[model samples]
Target: MLAFAAGFIVRPFGSLVFGRLGDMSGRKHTFLITIVLMGLPTFIVGLLPSYATIGMAAPIALIALRLLQGLAVGGEYGGAVTYVAEYSTPSNRGFNTSWIQTTGTGGLLLSLFVILGVRTLTGEEQFASWGWRIPFLFSIALLGVSMWIRLKLKESPEFEKMKVQGTRSKSPLRDTFGNRRNAMTVLLSLLGCTAGLGVVAYTSQFYVQFFLLQTLKVDGRIANEVLAIALVLGLPFYVFFGWLSDRIGRKPVILTGCLLAAVTYFPIYKSIAHYANPQLEHAHTMAPVTVYAPPGECSLQFNPVGTASFTRSCDSAKAALARNAVPYSTVAQPPGTVASIHIGEQVISAVDGKGLSRSQFAAQTAAFDAQVAHALASSGYPATAVPADVNRPMLVLLITILIVYLTMVYSPAAAWLVELFPPQIRYTATSLPYNIGNGWFGGFLPATAFAMVAATGDIYYGLWYPVVVASCTFVIGLVFLPETRFAAAAKISSARASTN
Candidate 1:
């Protein structure tokens, strides 16, 4: 968990470090180094021993590897966006920069496919044991390809021009912050524009997947397949909107996404609820499963990876139903007794937590969860919405709409951010806000939403997080963010005019 958190906490710092290198050394070489740093640690993570195997050293090593990834990603994006934007003209900058957005989705699709294939070949049991390592180890091949491609690339014209005239800032960091105008511009963009974009984009992809498997209670494999296909169907829109932005302006396309999400998320997810568990919905109308457990015995269901455990029998059983995204009301009982889960005429006794060691308790809870899942599935509660029962056509359309919103926000974001800062300190200025919004605002969604749902006992309530953030962006972005479609060209022209 500390390792995962490092990915968020260290990104702003990484942005500062790598941003300075790009400004001083040049984008191509600096980002090349970042790719190496990222890829090497990714490959090494596969080889790291687990906590069970190496005790304290295992977690420490994992945290270090994750930090390396965070650092590499932090520095890498600024260089990339700057490189692409520098080469683009005012007329088609959005269209060209859209490829960056497209490539990210493509990369996600590729990585997921690879992991799925490996899991399929290894079988779920074996995959859980050791097969997960293959995907991480596979990063080395991609790292090699990335290095070769980047090596063949030449430097951006903008950076070359700056170096030729001896106009590059000796202290890019100082210049970026000391110029209050530029500093404030980046800050506003982060909070008002990119922060919202971060949430929308992450929610569209990652949170959607979470809802399907964790909330809608879809089979993990089935959920993944559905997402992969949807991603494929929607991949082209990233570039499409990029072209559209070139014609209409970035502000409208981006804001429209936020607006669409803010207004329509409840419905989109409501539709998912209907498709994923029509039976549960029907049963829910007739009778909701009510859990009766002792106070503090039934812990709220919030399972962050590598953090928090539900140990008591009541907590474990309650968590099981919640993990499957079942809506249940709790009735408090006395302390230390087993939970009784009531479903219509049937009552299932929860596992007893007494007289068991820690490992034994964990094993007992795992069995208890499986039993509850089975009982629920047997009693007209779908573990996953049956393929035939699902509203496939609407599901596809909803998924596509969600992905479209993602493209709307993300397609022009890089170019807009690049345009926000002057070339000399562009790398430094752009990296900080971009990474912070993505790393913190976007990355924090799952855990935050988990808490929200747990507290309210409504599966859909967690969506308020994104809805609120996107709305804030929609209003602020409209009012404060300048039309940066031609910002780069304007800056370049001003530089040339001064020289003349």
Candidate 2:
């Protein structure tokens, strides 16, 4: 998790560096550099030694590699978007750039298919042990193909015109951030546009997968297959929304998507739970669970990688329940009382492991957990999602709706963003806001949502994170972000023509 977060954290710096390079040099070459940077790290990860073979060094190297990939991605997206928009006619900008939008979901669908194929071929045990690397290793061939395609492409026509006219900015960073007007635009773009779009992107696609595999305990293969199908169904909507935006407007489509996502996320997620794991959903209501413990003994346990030592009895009880996706209420007991969980009529006490030796602690903890598991089972909690109870078609429909929302926000975004800035320092200006919104706001979503669920003991509480973000985006964007369908593009064209 930390390694993944590292990639997101350093993305802004990459945006700053590569964005400037793209502006000062040319969009085509800078993005080509970024592709190589991203591809090499991804390919190396497959060949890198595992933790068992290299100890701490393996993870450290992994984190470093992730950072490099993040940096490249930060630079890569802005350049690609700018390149596509610049090459396109103003009338076709939204439609053409929407093809670029498809890549995000399209890549996800492709990766899922590849892994599903590899897993089916290799079998579960081998796939878990070694076949996992095949997907990452396969990136090398993709990199080669991408490079070949990109190499044959010409420079952006708008950028070439700017160079011919000698209107390019000498210092893209200063021109972008040092000016008050441009800086304000950047701030508004983050708050009213990219931030909301970023959260929705992750919430719809990535978080659903997490919810299924981790919280609902759905079988990995089944979950992947269903999600892949939903993605395929949802794929064409990106172009549809982009085409729609061309006729209507970008602002309305984007803000509408945000509004819809904010309003519907909770119910959508609940429906997902009900369909994906009917047994768990039934147990949640039929057998209400609660925790009673001394005040301050329970912590909002966020031990990613399962390494944190939650020694208090209350903390242990809550963590155990959270791991099993059992929603429960909490009640404070007297100071000296031990922590206990109540599932219907059954009561199971937890031991405080703080003062015990390692061996004693493990034994006691195991015994306590077994008791809780048994109690939960008796109260109708299934260990895993029952295949017979899963409503696969409904799950696909709900997920497709989510991706549709994603498309509305993301489809016309490239053209919208391009029109937000002038050609002088467009790359630097566009990349910063986009990366911050996605890298900081969107990237932290899964971790933040998981922590919220763990703390509140409501499996659905985590959804509030995206809800709030999308709501803010809808409100801010409605009032602040300008409609950039035709006016801004015309303004930019005239600005370029004036220099000529």
Candidate 3:
């Protein structure tokens, strides 16, 4: 936890530093540096020793590595967005900027796939102890690949034009924040776009996992697997939505998504509820069977019961019987029932047939088992031999809705943010607000939401945090955010006309 907090704390500073460097020097250079920095720490995290080996020092090292990661990420997004936006024509800005957005989803999906592959190969027990570390260590190779791509990327035309014109800001920070107008623009832009993007993005991904584990009581492995599948399925939508914004305009696309999210939030949650609950309306229509034991001591036994034993004492018989999924009519047993069942310390009593023949009772038990199986299959619960609760499927469905909203809003934001400022201060100006909104607001989502739930004692209340924030940003976007689809194109056309 300390590591996570420390990393977040350093992110804004990293953004400030890298943003300035990108604006002053070049976006491509800044991007390569941040990628290398981010990847190396991730690799080191995989190699770190556990508490048992190094005691308190282990956690300390982990925290330091997290801080490094935070710093690197803080700068990475801003540079990548600016680099892409600068090269793109204004008419296709949304579509081009979306490539940067898509990278984030791609990165997450890649991580999920790696984790899933490792788990499948190593199995659960071995994976927990050491197999989990392989993915993080493997990122060193990814970093090298990114570095190669970044090296090949050209400098932005806008920045080049600014340099030739001798119009680059002497002090980018002063120009960015020293002027009240620019500062207000930055703030309004973030409030209008990035804030909501941050919430939606985190809610869709991180909060879903928490909801599955804590609220819906889903098996962690199953929940993760479902989420991984959903994310991969939805990956194309990120770029598709980004392209749509180019045709329809950024504000409309974003506003439509936000409005749809607002209208559908409750309904989506309800759908999940219906799907997850076996007793709910859409649950599999299975006939229920009731099993009853006769008015005597009854023992429940499993087939292929290895080394199974029951005790002579009444309490022991009840305790042993309760562990099995036997449906008995009453809680109490008849007198002398306990003493009659002890055979070599293993109890064997006359299995009851409550108002039914032996064969009829057996049929009822089979029906109950079939119902349980149907419920488990419909719920997508883990296929363990033991019966488990079926609530996570609903939570997973809710997460899918959230992811849709997230991708819709976030995919276009890179273009919107990049277009808001001139090339001279674009890197620095965009990075500061983007990191704070995403790294600070979005990244802290799980921690903040969990803390709120812990304090309030209601899981649903934490959702209000994202809902309220997103709504406010949606309103701001409707009122304040401009359509930037044509801004760069207009500028280029004007430049060409002047030259002609």
Cα RMSD of all models vs. native, in order, equals: 3.4, 2.2, 13.5
CA shift at 494, candidate 3, in angstroms?
A: 2.4
Clashing residue pairs, backbone N/CA/C < 3 A, model 1: none
Better-scoring candidate (TM-score), 1 or 2: 2
Scored by CA lDDT, what does every candidate get?
0.83, 0.89, 0.67
> Model 3 clash pairs?
none
Best candidate according to lDDT: 2
Candidate 1 structure, TM-score to reference? 0.88
Candidate 2 per-residue lDDT, tens place, 257-294, comes to 99999999999999999999989878978999999988
Worst 10 residues of 3 by lDDT: 320-329
The best candidate by TM-score is 2
Instruction: Give the per-residue lDDT of model 1 (tens digit) for 59-96.
Output: 88888888988998899889998999899876688888
Candidate 3 lDDT tens digits, 1-500:
56666776788889888888888887777888898888998999999999999999998888788888888888988888887877777677788887778777687778778888999999999999999999988888888888888788888787787879988887888899988978887998778877777877777777766665555544567777778777776777788888988887777777667666666665665455344433422221232112222234434322121234322233232332222211112334456543212212222333233466657656644554354434444443323322144555455556666777877988888888887887788888888877777877777777666544433323444577677778888898888877777765677799999999
